[model samples]
Target: MPARARLADENVDFMSLMSEANRRRVLGKSTPVVYPAGTLLFREGDPARVILIESGLVRVFRTVPDGRQATVAFLRTREILGASLIVSDPPWVCAQIVIDSTITDLDVKTLRNVASTHIQVMTAVATQLAALVRNAHRLVALRSLGNITQRLAYDLLERACQSQLEMGRLDAMVTQEGLAASIGSSREVVSRAMKGLRAAGIIKTTPGVVRVVDPVRLSDTVRAFLRPT
Candidate 1:
């Protein structure tokens, strides 16, 4: 099937799983907004409001005490964000715009009220939180592995698979600096790693676009790194 058709099908499947009451509650409560490529949506400790990705993407990150930043998560279409603040009394991290993206901002008060009245909405929110925790643990595990390049290759390949399955292609609008931050490496290191992947025929990059060329091999490499010793 076509990429657009696949995207639509996936979206429909997602919506079909949502309860009708939850769907009605979400409607008209979210306001669509757009951000520039480099805009900072929210900072750590800033106020929290639920956001749904209408289109494009956003990166959630946190700043280290030493002043470096680390990317914690990537939010795409149909993904809900700001749950940390919604569920917790304290803020956990910051969110930033990785690319020019559109999002629907939902009022936290409204969401809280809906969650209080709708058991399904509350359950769904809890499920999403559990998934976030798992991803966080995976990142911690990845950080303990071989080298920066290896970690980056793992992250890139995993992300590529998700993007490919969701959008029917492996196209990422990421810079070397962004990849470095995500993988706990320097830009120079990420550059060298990109070169290595290109030489190995695993990926290709030009300017702002990174494309997966050999997804099967890339997946094998990631799996090998993740294997139990």
Candidate 2:
């Protein structure tokens, strides 16, 4: 509708392709749902439905046959999940609430009907999918290029980017299990990587927290690993 037109008329965040009109339209057909942290929004292979993240953080992950869950990505407010519905059935991924969040289960059929007619809405959805694919590719590329220490450095730098440095120390809020899931490695491997960083005088660790001594030095170290070997 008019919201789609506004997006077409001006350049907006490329990742946010959906218009407010589309969001409202989808919400009108959705049932509001609230979940506390640790709640599972849906599981892998669950029936596909449109998910509108109204507020808060969601971790999308995959559970291996061995019951280990690997973090794929995180979604926050105003992001649309399961846009893969535009095609046949979607590629299902389980979502767990990382924080108390408000969301909605949008009627997939309504969204499809509206998006079928609105090019902008579809474009936004396509853009979101592209972003996810790009992130996955980046992960693959990083893995191809570095050792666990390098990868852990990159992850620590990423965590630092999202957090604040207090008195020359930055905290990485992740359990070894969670960190292992994020890095696609085992807890023991990640622990060794942490020890490497500690030995290098780059970081100090406590339970569920990593204190970065010098973010600049850490960034420099990560870059060294990222360079051609």
Candidate 3:
């Protein structure tokens, strides 16, 4: 997307709802920063700092005792970075840079003060937490699906709608390994699923891209997975 379009897509428009003083408070206290792809922003026990994404994406995950990492959720531009600090009494999970992204950091205390002064800011924070919870729930639910392909198709369709991208465009960018990790499956499983979709004429796959050809059938397959057992 164009920079202008991305900003518009991510903009929360808090200024319309917040008082000038509150807006100034946040802007004045915020510090701009950037992270290259794969940088670890914060660990599980690290002190929480309020962050707002200026551009790009980040993934939140938990490191298992065995040292395996499972993706918890992904955040994009205009989304808050340290959400665990916002909603929880303590830090919950680690956040890392999934893509080269820019962010603005603000003291959590400053954000709390702003939220205190603006009901809209408080509501925005609450809505963000609700979205996080919903994503966590959806990841858990995806685990029961028979295979990685089914889970990947569901995730792509859902995220495309969330990001307002068309299905074919979404498929063109999503990778098999990324899809596998998102659905808690192996890359081989995801690859096989892609092959199946290709054979059925539901999608076409290249080395790193999969293009959706039959959205109707894909939607039907996804719907069937959601039907009452």
Candidate 4:
């Protein structure tokens, strides 16, 4: 069996999910707050609250049974953390500020009120929630079932797909340490996987960037990471 990348639509973020007018409307009803690095915005099992990142980086993670935190995803400017909260049942994930950031809190009650008044907003939130769930399920599978190499391949492919192009290549702006954390491996292990990828003409790397020169091959590589259950 071959590994394949998920559909592009499965990668929806908040800015991508909402229209300009809809975004403005939501933001208008939200309160922006500045948070410093090391701030834990929310913790696992905590009630969900929609937080829109206006600037800086946020690391979303979940605590495993061993009490170690496993990286879930990173949220950046214009991305919404706790988007799954829009649905009745949200996953238990904690969000921490990786860099000093400004976030807009779209109070759940306020969002509900606005959503009730606007069908388009409700539709967009529903769509975003559905995609978040699908992506979450895939992430869980990759973390639990994939090997180090497969996990590394999938991480690079996912980040590349979300990044902008440079010289016809996709640059995933993440450090090896970040990759290690995201993939639940040591930095050395991730470095070895990266070396293999580079040797195979799958990627090129700089200090804090991984450029995918062959996305088709990377995509095919990721397909080998997961199988239908």
| Candidate topping lDDT | 4
Instruction: List model 4 lDDT by residue over 91-132, tens digit each.
Output: 688777755789988877767766888887777677666545
| Winner on TM-score (2 vs 3) | 3
User: Which 10 successive residues of model 3 have the least lDDT summed?
Assistant: 161-170
Q: Candidate 4, which segments miss by more than 4 Å at Cα?
A: 1-13, 19-21, 29-31, 45-47, 64-66, 87-91, 144-150, 153-191, 194-229
> Candidate 2: lDDT over CA atoms?
0.67
Candidate 4: C-alpha RMSD after superposition = 9.3
- Local accuracy of candidate 2 as per-residue lDDT tens digits, 1-229: 4554433222123335657876676556567688875577788888887787877766677777886655565565666678788756786688876557888777888878877888876787776666566555544576556777767876885564334322223577878898788778899999988888899898888898887775546655554543332
lDDT of 1 by residue, 1-229 (tens): 6433333322222223358868768544566888865466777767766777776655666777885666566555676677655667634676665446788887777778877887777766665665555555555576666476668766775565345434656766678888888777799988988898899988889897688776546645543444334
Please give the TM-score that candidate 4 achieves against the real structure: 0.56
Ordered from best to worst TM-score, the candidate numbers read 1, 3, 2, 4
User: Which lDDT values do the candidates have, in the order given?
Assistant: 0.64, 0.67, 0.62, 0.69
RMSD of each: 9.2, 9.3, 9.6, 9.3
- Give candidate 1's whole-model lDDT: 0.64
For candidate 3, lDDT tens digit of each residue in 1-229?
5432333233333334456766677667566788875577888878767777877666667777886666666666677756446545744677766456898886777777767777766766665665556555655566674356667766655443222222214354668887887778888887788888889987777776666666546645554443334
Cα TM-score per model? 0.62, 0.59, 0.60, 0.56
User: In terms of TM-score, how similar is model 2 to the real structure?
Assistant: 0.59
